[model samples]
Target chain A: MPDPTSSPTLTVDSAAPNPAPNPAPNEASNETLGRFNFLAVIGRIILAFFQQVGRLSMFTASAVSHCVRPPFFPRQLLGQMVEIGYYSLPVVGLTTIFSGMVLALQSYTGFARFSAEGAVATVVVISITRELGPVLAGLMVAGRVGAAMAAEVGTMRVTEQIDALTTLSTNPMKYLVVPRLVAACLMLPCLVLVGDVIGVYGGYLIGVNKLDFNAASYIQNTWDYLETLDVVSGLVKAAVFGFLIALMGCYMGYNSRGGAQGVGVSVRNAVVSASILILISNYMITELFFAQ
Target chain B: MSASPPKIALSGVKKRFGRKVVLDGIDLEVAPRESVVIIGGSGTGKSVTLKCVLGLLKPDAGSIKVDGEEVVGLGDRARERINTKFGMLFQSAALFDSLTVWENVAFGLIQGHKMARRKAREKAIEKLAQVGLGADVADLSPSELSGGMQKRVGLARAIADDPEIIFFDEPTTGLDPIMADVINDLIVKCVKEVGATALSITHDIASARKIGDRIAMLYHGKLIWVGPAATVLDSGNPYVDQFVHGRADGPIQMELRG
Candidate 1:
């Protein structure tokens, strides 16, 4: 008799034939089924995309709702502002200056052929203020800040720190996401403004030093052609891009599952999605402001 | 006046993650100032049940009452108000690494209660002392502390508000045997000192016997046995006996999946 404490053993039927006789036929059938389900696969992908968008919309709405409520964490907000805005200055400035310099040089090469070298300064300032400054700064901040937020918040989610906050009578959205959202919204514009100045200075450097244009003329050309609307539109784009970057990072991180691999995936998704949204929204905003 | 109801009561609690049922028909009660421990093997819905009580995860169907008030579908503000009465010690300590020890301990006090930082820090330091931590450790980041110290700091944080109810999730997990016992002792001491109702979930039989007044054994998402801590070893149920004695050969079989 089997020991009463031991788990019962399963008895196999030795006389039964093996069930793998038609493996080749099974493989053919599976291949045929997979080929027939191509549309079903695409349909599933579309459904998943819409589901993700719906979830993100709800998350954004909830975060925005929490923003106007009381129990505001001023300290946390200031900390995020300093992180998302102040610490990001060096990289944003560097990217915009280099971009402006490259644009001025390229414009000079193209415009010199048309006997319009004077337009090089105009092109640099317009591109920098209305397009390059905000776009480049937004992308740089997304890569720097978005990935970090995703990784940090994703780690917190996996480790149960987010749930800990909830049990402590703290709303994770208000305590975590709102401060980040607010800071990113307020700070990205400032970064873009600073970046615009540096970018114009970079173009001025290239125009005067490399292209043999008079320094005063280059400055005057930039100032004459640069419209208030150009800079304002760029700043507005910066704010929107800021919201997208933070929202994507927070959303991806907040929902991260599994473990370190999950956090890694979230970071990648946050950076990629934020960059794409920044580019797409940049075009939309540019169309809104400058389209005839 | 109606006699004071249980601090926490759950009836017919059920939860599932996709196709896998983590909890099924869980029923439990902890009276005022009483300590109840749910002992279960790994993956037995211990944490899920605790989370349902904390409103971190909603049950698919159930009635969860706190102070005889139905809390199952309460609004966010109402849930937050109810949560003010709770303190939890996570299995891994889960201290916010961004904050210092005192700041971590005083987080709920400052952020939740809106207590002044100075006063909250004082309270945090006092609670830390109760958990046998020194003032010097207060300024250090949570990453700076050892696992045992982190658990102690976590305990200190849990009792910082002197909450009416405290939940300890796998209180002795990831510690050496001696350190585990030390934490178990501190848990008993702290729960008594604060006069708080305690609901702890752990697979550590020693911890259950030491810290729990009443012990409930959970198996396959249900309570298989519940008895006074002193009588747990003699529960007479094969599942409970298998768990309490830590036996490999028994009715309880490990579900090993690829």
Candidate 2:
């Protein structure tokens, strides 16, 4: 007799084949169907990606055109500048200072192995002005301001306030998106500039107090090594990152559907996409400035 | 008496999203100074009709003429010019939360017409009084008001610019019975006061009777019956009779999924 363990398996096999009603003939067809489905899913994903990219480019073009057009709202623009730039100072300041101190410490530790600890000041200034200052500030604002913009605009979309604006003969694009875009693009560079100063100061404090360096020479090294090109490239990157962050935030919020859950999705998407765009664009900008 | 062109008209209008059709060949007209209310259940395209006429939506196929001028695909500046003659009250009141009550009311005036702030404020306060709201509430945010009060403020805003046409979207949707009647009265008073041609969409029979001069019943994306509001209860049409009575067993079957 067949082994007892094999009995259940034998019975299941018999039952499965009978229920399928000619499974042998359909197996190849089923495999083909599954392969077709897999290909279809991938095709749909690629199409959706390109569709989103196209829509985003169109939105950016319209927003830029509106910025240059007439009928601007000065009060709205001013209020946004205060909110985006001035109110973000404390958080941005804290981030850059801590980053500067840590960079100084780590660079000194690494260079001391080669008896090159004197290079700490140059490293700190260069890193802060070229990369750390703008990147850190952008990531922080993406978390703070980008999420807030998404939530606010998403709520307006769901509640029909944006439609109400249209009914009132006001263009929502001109009134809402234009002001935020202009404000973010203009104000982020200024924030990065301030952050650069605060960051270098933090590095200086650490060099004098913790590392037993001469304050005068530390200052001299920082000022002497700093180049105008480094600062200008970073500021330009900050402006581009600002535009990307605001555009992504506004785009997500403007297209959000449903209710509270929709608003939540928009907020999460705004932060995640803004952060990713900031990092990706950071590389491209650095490559542009540094590549031979 | 001569036959004048309708202030608003829709002929063979159709709109669909993907495979689902929301409006299929809708034809309607609202004469100048007339209040026409369309009644239908959820997803029956009542709001879509109003939006089409307002140029907030573009129908897939049809003609929407306001005063003999086709508005189906007008440019932005032309649309804005046409929209100056229109005002709308949303289902949710939809006041701007960022602004105070007076600012919300004066928004169309200040932003659209470029009115002076002082003059707009005075006009907003005056409109507020017309809707039974006091000047004390003008500085408060929209969140602080009761639903009824917010509705009143919305009405004040809609008429503040003296628009020639007004659209009310579910004017009495989320209110107590007494407050609903009060809003009805205010709508009648406001429409008469502003002398605006009105178009509204709602499912409340009582509201339809009170605010609508002519009642049209929309079913499956088509207006099945249009008649005087006073005769709505006895229209004798199966769909109209079934809907006005709110009966479950009727020719218009509710799509229930098990």
Label model 2 with its docking quality class.
medium
Clashes of 1: 0
lDDT of 1 by residue, B147-220 (tens): 99999999999999999999999999999999999999999999999999999999999999999999998899
Scored against the native two-chain complex, candidate 2 gets a DockQ of 0.64
TM-score of 1: 0.95
Model 2 segments more than 4 A misplaced: A1-32, B256-258
Write down the TM-score of every candidate.
Answer: 0.95, 0.94
| Candidate 1, superposed: residue stretches over 4 Å from native | A1-32, B1-4
* Candidate 2 Cα lDDT to native: 0.92
Q: Give the top-scoring candidate (lDDT).
A: 1
Question: Candidate 2 on A4-63: residue-level lDDT in tens?
Answer: 989999989988877478777678788888979899999999999999999999999988
Instruction: Give the TM-score comparing model 2 with the true structure, all chains together.
Output: 0.94
**Cα error, candidate 2, residue A113 (Å):** 1.3
